[model samples]
Target: MKTKKFQGIVQVQYEQARQSIQTGDLLFCSGTYLISELIKKASNSFMSHVAFLFEWNGRVLVFESVESAGVRIIPLSHYVTNYNNTGRKYKGALYLARHETLIDSSFDRTLLQNMIGKAIGSLNRNYDQTELIRILTRISLGVGRHKENEAYICSEFVDQCFRQIGIRFPRTEAGFVYPEHIAADPHVYPMFEIVP
Candidate 1:
């Protein structure tokens, strides 16, 4: 892996992942911190910063920004390969499980709406709800109809994230249902309408 500079950001560029130090760059760093004091300070402050966990040179690195608008880029190869290349085996499993356990054809709009609400509520405790929703919405839109398993995996991962943050999520229903009215009633449940 080579550490390169992109637009004045210190970046570690690898075949699978890339890192950069730039303004507005959020890094979801994983692993133990060497300087606990600095980590504490950064964690307490930098609320507007974007950070995420990424691997570099086969090791995980904490990519942080000293300024705003800086982004640390990590190619998906660092985490997992493209689902298309794997014949969607992993994706299929995720979808079947979600469809069987979390969502099914018999589910009403209210249940789906409730699931979304619970998902959002769980995320709100740790990150900004608006931002999380934006991210999730983008992901959902990109998923389309063909990637059912991918969507299911994403939903399940989100639920797990909520749990990790000590947020309790409502039990999601099985199967998909329509009659959008259930989502329209604000008093009934919070709905995250996916826009096409």
Candidate 2:
């Protein structure tokens, strides 16, 4: 399948691109927070976080697992326009992308629905802080391996959701995944870099 290279992807303001956002679209962020920096460094990736987009009842929602909230859904508007109600947008560069297979005609819509249901079922799951630390430590020390736990980190959660629909990002030897892994998946293609 033809794909747009990340470096050549167009940048669109959220206000202008929001209406065209679709369910299953991926949202990537390179956040400016301390944890974001740490995650980026540990993952050796430009993106620190990834989330799924769903349009529910006329509102666009972002489904993400976060350190503070675990697996939760929030308005995309709130995330981009008033994150935490601070009257400021999220501190990061945001990009929008899609998994092409999810849009293919032969791909089962029922399977897509089931995958979304599975992700929604994961709501309220705790963020795997322990796994995050372990991944960081292993990456830093160049030792050890990752083991799955009950909690979910942002990329791992998104990766799991995609896996449910038969799209698996390549896993690392450490058995861990990160935002860059998801972004680099062969089935996913860059669409836009969301701008303020």
Best by lDDT: 2
Best model number under TM-score? 2
Q: Indicate the residue-level lDDT of 134 in model 1.
A: 39
In order, what is each prediction's RMSD in angstroms?
A: 20.3, 2.5
| Model 1 lDDT per residue over 1-196, tens place | 0101111232233332232221111222221333222322432311112122333465543222221212223333332334225532211100000112222346343344443344334331322223333333444454212122212222233333323323333321322111111111121221111111
State each candidate's clash count.
Answer: 21, 0
Measured against the true structure, the TM-scores of the candidates, in listed sequence, are 0.19, 0.92
Model 1 spans with C-alpha error above 4 angstroms: 1-96, 99-103, 124-196
lDDT of 1 at 20: 25
| lDDT of candidate 1 at residue 42, scale 0 to 100 | 31
Model 2 worst lDDT run, 10 consecutive residues: 1-10
Question: Over the stretch 1-196, how does candidate 2's per-residue lDDT look in tens digits?
Answer: 1222565578888888887788889998888999999888878888889999988898888999999989999998876779878999889888888899966879776776866897889999999989888888888897767777667999889888888888888778878888888888887888888877
TM-score of 2: 0.92
